[model samples]
Structures are given as C-alpha cells and as structure tokens.
Target: MWAKRYLSLDASRPAWAYALDAIIANHTTKSAKAARPRTKINVFLQDWNANTTTRSGLPVYARNLLNTAKKHNLSLGAIKMDKNLKRKLPLWYHLGADKHLKKLNNTTISDCLREKHGVTTIASLQRALRGEGGCDAPIYGQESVRDNCTCTTCQDLRGRGCKHPRRCRQAADRLLHFILPKWNPEDATPGDGLTLTRRRKRRNQDMLETSEGDFVFDPSVTEKGELSEAFRVFVEEDTTRHPPALRPARGRVVHQGKPPVQLKTSSTVFNALRAWKSAQEQMVSAQLAQDKSATLKKR
Candidate 1:
C-alpha cells in the first residue's frame, strides 16, 4: 500500500518534497523511537538505508531526499524490516520504515556534515545536498610564514642588510658591555692587583726588552730553561736560609769508646747537597791537575 502511494506521487515534484512527504506520513501514524518531530525525520531517512536489502532499487527522488537530509545535518537510525509489512509492500518501503530510530540534533549534525563537505554555510549546504560542487573554500586558511621569523629587521629588509645599522650596532654594543665590562687601568698596582692594562703594558715592555736581549734568554726556550733555573734557585736559596744538619753523637762529649756519629737529612735535600759537593770536588780536582802541569813546566 505504501509502495503504491509512493509510486502514485508525481515524478515532477522535487526529490526533497517527495521524500519529506514520505517521512511525514511514515512517522505520523507510527510510534517512531525518536520522540521528537525533528528527530523522527532523521530516523526515517536512516531506516531507509538500513531496512532495504539493496539501496540500488530506491527511487531516485528518495535517494536525493536522503542526501538532502544528510546535508541538513540529520542523524539516521539503522533500518530494520517488519516481517508483516515486508510481505505487503516493496522491500524498499518496508525497510525504509522499520529500522531503529536514531536521534538527530540540528546543530550537531549540521556542524558534522559541514566539516564532512568541507564547507561552512547553509547555501553551500544546499549545493552539497544537490550534489553540486559549490564554492571551494578551504576548511582552514593558510598560516603566514612571515609572522614567525626571528630577525625582525632582516625579515623586513628581506635580502638587504639591516636598514638601521646604527641601532643594531648600539644594541650589540650594549649587550657586550653587559657581558664584559671595560678595563680600568687606574685599578692596577705593583702588588697582586694589576689591572689588565698594566699587565698588558708590563708584558709588552718585557717582550721588547727580551727582543733586545737584555735578559739573554729566548722566550721559546723559557719553559725548559725556567724549570732548570727554578731548581738551581731553590737549592741555593734553601742552603742559604737553613743551617746544615748536625750529626748525632753517642755521648755528650768525645770519649775513646764512643760509637761513630750518624748524620741524618731528608732524601731530597741530601741528594741536592750531594750533587753540589760533587761539583765542588770536580772543580778542585781540575785545578790541582792544572797546577801539577804548570809546576812540571817550571821544572
């Protein structure tokens, strides 16, 4: 009966109009799960897809209406066939009516459908429903690359050097001043608190004197020569500053039966003293040999 009435409708009517009439008729008499009038419309459309074995046989008008409802942001329920109704009407009509009624809210479905179609407005909504390619508006506008560049002047100048070189130089100078203070020559002294300027001046004077051979030293050989000089100076200074180690005696006074005296000194100091004594002995031996030769000549 529903199929006959559906077929009887004028084919000339707009697809949405026919589909809307079918939805209203099916929902008004029946207890659709969707309690609200608006909700029932969405539920009926969803059921059309669910109950039919093949959506291919659905009238073109019905298909277009379903598409329109989807564009309008309708939520659809799963369609189920009523066995009793299935025997009487075409499978399409029975299936269209019996599916589980799904709830549809206008705002939510509209937003969702809008996103799906990649459009935002209702006129575009209508065009999408009609299967027309509406205006091509990107879902999101392109992000600006220029906004994120760090060097403001460089970015503004593009390929050119900074237009405000003075300002840039001043900023750089200020930054350097903050990081490193200017050296004050007045703060320098001869003790331990020489300013960088004084130290530099002394270094320059030393270099000039060294170049003129005042110290009779080569800066290149200073490292090794300085080590040798330091050793000699340390030994001479130590010997001059400290008295020689005294030997330990067995008795307070000399006695015929007294044991031999023993001398003690640190190994390091002892070795240094031994080396100095050996050098003095070599000098005396060489002088004696020279005297012997001279005496022989006189004879």
Candidate 2:
C-alpha cells in the first residue's frame, strides 16, 4: 500500500493505483489550463524624472497603445483623467489641466492619448512623476530633413501651402454653388444643385444696367487661370462692398485657400432680388386672402 502511494507506478500496477494516477493527471491538466502564464509587458527608462522633467516616456507607451488600438480597429472608451495629477506634478504641466487633470492647452489629454503620444494613463503618470533624470529635449518634435521637409509639423512651421488642388476645388465649388443663386437668379436652372451655368459675355458691357455689365464667368471658368483670377477679384471686391449679417469677423490674414469674403451679388443685382422677393411675398398674401374669402362665402 505504501509503495502504491509513494512510488511511480507502471502499466503493470494494480487497477486502484491506475485510478489514482488518472485523478492526479486530470487535476494537473486543469491547473495548467486555468493558470496559463500571461505575457508581461515591461516599461523601462534609463534616467527619467517624474517630479521635474516635462517628459516621462509615458508618451511613447501612450503612442504604442494608440497604434495597437488602431491596428485592431478598436474604439477606446472616452478619455478619462485621474484627478491626482495636480498634487503629484508641478504647476507648469498643469496649465489648462482641468479639475481632473484631463486637458492640456484646452485639448483633452485623453483625446491626445488615443491620437498621439502624451501622458495618458496612471502607469504613464506614475512613470512621469517618478522619473528621476533625463535630457530636456522635446520627446517628439520636427525631424531634420535634407531639404524641403514635408512632415506636417515642419510644413506648418514653414507656412507651406496645401499642394492638393482637389480639396481647394471642392471648397471653392461648395462656396460658388451656394452663392450663385443669390448672385444671378436667371442662370439658376432647374436641376441638381451641384450644376451651375455662367452667363456668356455680351458685346458691350459699358452700361451698368445691361446684361453685359452683370456678366459673371461660367462655372467652367474655374478651370481657366486668367478667368478664375478675374472671378476671384470680382468676388473679393463685391463681398467687401457690403457687410452681410452672417459674415464672420476677419481677424488674421490667412494666405492659403480662399479669403474669408462673404461674396454675394452686386448692389444692383441685390436690389432687384429684394424687389422680386417682396413681390413674391405680396402674391402669396393675396392668394391666402382670396382662399379665406371663398371659404367664408361657402360657409
């Protein structure tokens, strides 16, 4: 009995001994599956100070997390901030940091956490707060290029204009289509709103009252260099002549894209438009009155 319990058993062992070995094997298999080892992720830093330094390499980890989330096409729940960061870190890092230390420069840190590398989670925060010593270089800044750096940060710093003409064209089309009806009601045909027609050039445009004076380049003029410049100048001049209620206040001069001019029809065209709208209102009022009188007579 002692040998059966203590010593290893072979195939020649008794049936009771075999049954005991089977039970032990089943328990060992269950334990192995239940307690499968997890792959541990290690965060290491040579000399990072959490209390003094602006960076803690947490941004690197945050960036990794963001990439992983994107690779798997997962949407992390909304960014949350731990409230204890203010007490843990210096006041400078807490600039614009909210009650829960959620934001930096009015942008949510959690948003940056998912989009770019930045101090995000508690682990990263601890790393930053506990960081001891490191150089004061920006963790991620404009990388040096041989010539004409095209990285977004460098391009923005250099005030590089948008090279993509399609985006500019789309924005221009949206504005032109939106303003075309207000500028010339005659040219607005019944069709999809995307379509527009430009008035043909008349023989003489000396008179301001004539159709020649009111000529605007056709929608196809956007494809022409000289005509497009002329159109742009006309738009800028006309919009600046009168301030519209909806026009946003001009602050700084932006060189790229279209200028912020709320271009509309010239004064003569606008006056005619106003008169036509007034006549429409009167016609609607007269129709309503006639219908009301007829209904009363029938009653």
Candidate 3:
C-alpha cells in the first residue's frame, strides 16, 4: 500500500534530505510496476525574522519530487498546465508566452468561416447573409463576334455564320430581323395601373424639342467658308446673353414669378466656353488657309 503525508510548518528546513530519506525508507517486496509508490510531501518552514525567505523553496520541493520519483523507477513526465489556465491569468502575464495561450477563447475556425464566407451552421437560420455567392452569369447565352459573309446584313449577324448551304442566309436574315427594344416596363398586367400612353407622349415631346435646335452644318456654306467665323461669334454671344434660369428662394417659380438675381461667373462654364471658342478659331483658320492655297493654285 502507498503512504501519504500532509505537513504544516512555521520555519524552513532541508526538504531534499527529508525527501531522500522517505524514498529510502519506503520499500515494497512486490513488483515495481504493480506496487503503488509513496509520495514524500513537505510544507515549507517559513522564517518570518530571517532575511532569506522560503520563496526559493518552491522549486526545491518540485526538484525533490522529481528526484524521488526517478530513484524509485517511476515514470515522470513534464508538467503540463491546463489549456484554459492562461485565460484565467491577466493579458500581460501571457503576452510573451506561447502564442496559442494568447489567442481569444471565443475565436475559433468556425467563427472565422462565418465571418469571411457569410455561413453559420452553428445556429439554425433559414437563409445565409447577402453576397455569399460569386458573380452570376446570364441565363440566355449570347456570343459576340462576326464571321465571313460579304452582304452588310449578313455581316451584322454576330457569331459564326450558319454552315448549312440552303438555310444559311435565311437563318442570318431571321437573326437580323430580330428587333430588341431597349426599354422594358416592370408591371404589364391589364389592371396593374401601368399605362404606355403617358410615357409615349413625354418621349415624343422630348424628341421634338431636341430636333428643333439648328445644330446641323450646311455643306455648301462650309465649302465657301461663309458661316465659319459668324458661327463662332453667334455661339459665344448667345451663351453670354442667355444664362440658365435661377431658382426661387421662398416658393415655386409660378408663386414668386422670378428668382433672386445673384450675378456670379462660373469658372467651369467660362473655361468650357473658352475651349469651344479656341477650337472654332482653329477650324476657321485652317479652312481659310486651305481656300487661299486653292486660289493661288488656280492663278
């Protein structure tokens, strides 16, 4: 049977001597592997008055335990602290120690996966978070590129042209005839309160106003260099004369009839207008030079 001792002391002693004596005295006739070993215990004798305290006696007791175990042919493994022991200690205590000890208790590989991939199998939820999947591809596959075919309409048909002899041009013609309208309305049911009449009217009015402006260049006048300088002057003078309408401060434009007059010169607008005028001058100068060259050649 194994023997154990618990001691309390007021002063320090030679614990190593006591430990060695205990190891020598406690012996059994049975096989070493089958027999339970007796452990030598020591309580440090603390000297309150002495300058040399029992603080250094801790490691001595540890060493004595290890030596006693070794002398008795007992297996002695290195001491291992609990994994969560560092968590109980303060942050500063474990800062310079093992990196695994410094890691947060709540942080895990599952937590990281949840953070990066937007997936959490830890809890029961219906759907995962947004942006979990990568970029989506179009449902109807459409290839971009042209192939051999001399006709303009056939050339416009994208992708490799139909290889079959009789139906090749016919297939290209059918594909070319396909008219894809740009705008698509969201709700198209009969009672869905959606009407195309109002939208069509607004679109037509915008188109008419856009076409009313005289922006087209006359080929005959351009040949004679007649309206080149005059066009430049007209653009500059018109921009200066009519500025954009100002907004009313208190109410609607109809309620106030006129906005507060604040005269300000926009640097951006001025620079743009200056650039336009410079370009116009360059064009006119080039045209005049070309005309003079032509006249000299004729003489």
Best by TM-score: 1
Best by lDDT: 1
lDDT of each: 0.34, 0.30, 0.29
Superpose all Cα atoms of candidate 1 onto the true structure and report the RMSD in Å to 1 decimal: 45.3
> Residue pairs in steric clash, candidate 2?
47-133, 48-131, 48-132, 49-131, 49-132, 50-128, 50-129, 50-131, 198-218
Better structure of 1 and 2 per TM-score:
1
lDDT of 2 by residue, 1-299 (tens): 22322222224545654443333223222213222121001111000111111232234433443334334433211111123321222221121222332112223322322123223333333332222122122232353232243444434423434332222222222222232221211222222222243223332333345544544533331121111111111133233222223223267833543347877679999999999999999999999999999999999
Estimate the overall C-alpha local distance difference test score of candidate 3.
0.29
Tell me each candidate's TM-score: 0.18, 0.16, 0.14
Please give the range of 10 consecutive residues that has the lowest summed lDDT in model 1. Answer: 180-189
How much is the lDDT of residue 124 in candidate 1? 34
After superposition on all CA atoms, how large is the RMSD of candidate 2?
33.2
Error of 3 at 75 (Å): 99
| Model 2 TM-score, all chains together | 0.16
lDDT of 1 by residue, 1-299 (tens): 22223323234334655665544434332334233333232223223232221344545555554455444433311111122211222111111221211212233432333334322222333333332332222222353223223444334432343333223323222222221011111111112121245555566688787774233222221111111121121123233222233334445744443358988689999899999999999999999999999999999
